[model samples]
Target: MSDPLVIAVDSSTSATKAVVVDKSGQVLSTGKADIDLLTPGMDMYEHDPVQWWESTETAISQACAALSDADRQRIKALCITHQRESFALVDEDGGALRPAILWLDSRAGDEIKEYGSDHIHELSGKPADTTPALYKIAWLKKHEPEVLTSAHKLVDVHAYLAHHLVGRWVSAVGSADTLNLLDIANVDYSDELLDIAGVTREQMAELAQSASIIDTIKKELTDSWGIPGDVVLVAGVGDGQAAGLGTSAIDEDVAYVNIG
Candidate 1:
């Protein structure tokens, strides 16, 4: 019998990575790609979504290439952990609508204030800030109206990668919650927020649980990358949530803090 395999993809603010692990959580292979976050001005940081996609692809391909055919055949699932809130818009054809505004982009400070920070905190359990997609969307609409008008979907980083991997757009509940467009208590996008952001429901990806299987690896990609075509792609959670689970900090009363 073969050892069961799992692939983990971590897409964070500074880089993207992939790791192949056995059932025992021992890593067999790992790959990483650095991404440059561009700050063109004060309160504005951006990245090319196309570059992000390429980085993710490079990481996955490199990881898979390091495995033998027998090792690849044992792969059971591919799970992702990603940065939250940072997003890019795409047209019907999946092409980027514009450069993605990162989580640290504060160009939407006025929009966050307009949405009323107290009200946002009450609804989403977090204050309105540059870290939420709502503010970024507002920034795009105000300053890049052309791009906003062209966009058919508003997608976070994970959803974008999932779409490229499985050939379908999917959003995770935990990730969606970080968007500030979702009612955290209800775990769905808020109509009130749509009204506030002037976006329609159709603009968002369908939501699924963080652990749900979204799709299998598409044959072309699998063949090209020497990975099993039947590998399951699981819906990804936000990085913080995945870290909590990996570190066994899911229990209440425990808080994980990052100093840097």
Candidate 2:
């Protein structure tokens, strides 16, 4: 007779939050973990990739600790949403290659000038702004070419977390759209964009639709967190997309703004 429960995780720039919600749309529990934002130089922001994963696990654990045994058992899914336009590189083993470049990084100013064009803008729904991940990735090719070639996967936060959670290097299409690498109209990767970023489609996570199952949580995480091994891991949209969903502004005509 108990309401079904769902755990939602939001991994943003400064912090990660985990909220447990029931079928009736009320939040049953909430938890958060702070992350350090590194500003190595002017307009360059970075986050330790390891810290992202660690903070996510800690936040989810904190959230679940607030739930009762019965409530935890009733949980049906783990859903994740995150900041848009942030990205990192991972090895074949899912080990992080380096700190993640933040969406605001201006290190690729020159590359932006070169790659910025009407064709690219039309190909990707996003404009050629510093906010997109590709410009900074191009900067990596010019300055640290080895890093780009050495990387096994050019992933967003969702792909990294999904790998850890479900053993799949796949991400929600909606979340991957933030990378500026996908053809938003087609909801898939753009070959031209990949060439500009110095990566191949093989180096990206397999795409899954938002709200679908990427995979199930692995036994290791389930055991460590005291969650069921069979718990489903659902693909989640970008934070902006989630906001629209949360606000009941499902129509494109309706604008949802976050004052924060």
Highest lDDT against the true fold, candidate? 2
User: For each candidate, what TM-score against the reference?
Assistant: 0.95, 0.96
lDDT of 2 by residue, 11-71 (tens): 9999999999988888988889999999998888999888778889999899888887777
Give the Cα lDDT of each candidate: 0.82, 0.87
Where does the lowest 10-residue lDDT sum fall in candidate 1? 221-230
Q: Cα RMSDs of all predictions? A: 1.5, 1.3
Local error of candidate 2 at 25, Å?
Answer: 1.8
lDDT of 2: 0.87
TM-score of structure candidate 1: 0.95
**Candidate 1 overall Cα lDDT vs. reference?**
0.82
